[model samples]
Target: MPVKIRLQRHGKKGKPFYWIVAADVRAKRDGRYLEKLGVYNPNTNPATIELNLDGAVDWLQNGAQPTDTARAILSYKGAMYKNHLIGGIRKGALTQEQADEKFNAWVAQKEGQVQGKVQSLAEAQAAAEAKAFEAEKAVNEARIAANAPVVEDAVEDAGETPASEEE
Candidate 1:
């Protein structure tokens, strides 16, 4: 039986969440999975993905094909790379320790890149909020200045001595 690694949609409309699963290719998109591998949540800024790396690599090595989106997700999470390393190990091109070391180094580098992106995005959002706040503050100060003369005129029209003059 042909097998596939694919996503199954689950969350509410407009806020989509997905489950990564291994299943028969003929199964319905969301039905009859052989294993629940992990999850993907695109609602968050960085588009969160939590995958079972070993499980995914196992499926790949066993001949389960991945859909395009699933392939991208697997690539991002390092399953594809891990599978490649395993293949290298099988072909005597790399020792297990060497393959493991390479995979670990790659994972570390990917994590650093993700962290850097998150930090940059956070900094940009903070700067935008600060700029908006300053503009709003300036507008409020200008409005107060514009209304001051009108307030004084109304006081005089009502024959009430302005508070400053009375004092």
Candidate 2:
């Protein structure tokens, strides 16, 4: 039986979340699946993907073709790269230790990149909030300044003697 790795849509109307599954090629888009491999949440800023790397690679090795979007998700999560390394090891082009080291290094690098993006986003949000606060402060200060002279003039016109004059 021809098998396929695909995404099954599951979230609400506007926000879409997906389940990565291995299913028969003839199965409906969101129907029966042999196994659910992971989840893909695109609602987040970085498009969070939680995948079972081993399961995905196992399906790939067993000749399960991935849909285009599923392929991209697998690639993003390093399943494809891990599979490639496994292929190299099988062909005697690299040792298992070397392949593992490379994969680990790649995962570490990818994690660093994701962290950097998250940090930058937080910094940008803080800067925007600070700018807004400063603008609001300036507006309030201007309003108080504008009202100051008018208040003083009214006090004088109402024949209100200064405390020093009353003394």
Tell me the deviation in Å of residue 14 in model 1: 1.6
RMSD of candidates 1 onward, in order: 3.6, 2.7
Q: Candidate 2 local accuracy as lDDT?
A: 0.96
Candidate 1 minimal-lDDT segment of 10 residues: 157-166
Tens digits of per-residue lDDT for model 2 on 1-167? 99999999998999999999999999999899999999999999888999999999999999999999999999999999999999999999999999999999999999999999999999999999999999999999999999999999998867666655788
Displacement of the residue 166 alpha carbon in candidate 1, Å: 17
Cα lDDT over the full model 1: 0.95
Candidate 1 lDDT by residue in tens digits, 34-77: 99999999899899999999899999999999999999999999
| Per-prediction TM-score | 0.90, 0.91
The true-versus-predicted C-alpha distance at residue 129 of model 1, in Å, is 0.9
Determine the backbone clash count of candidate 1: 0
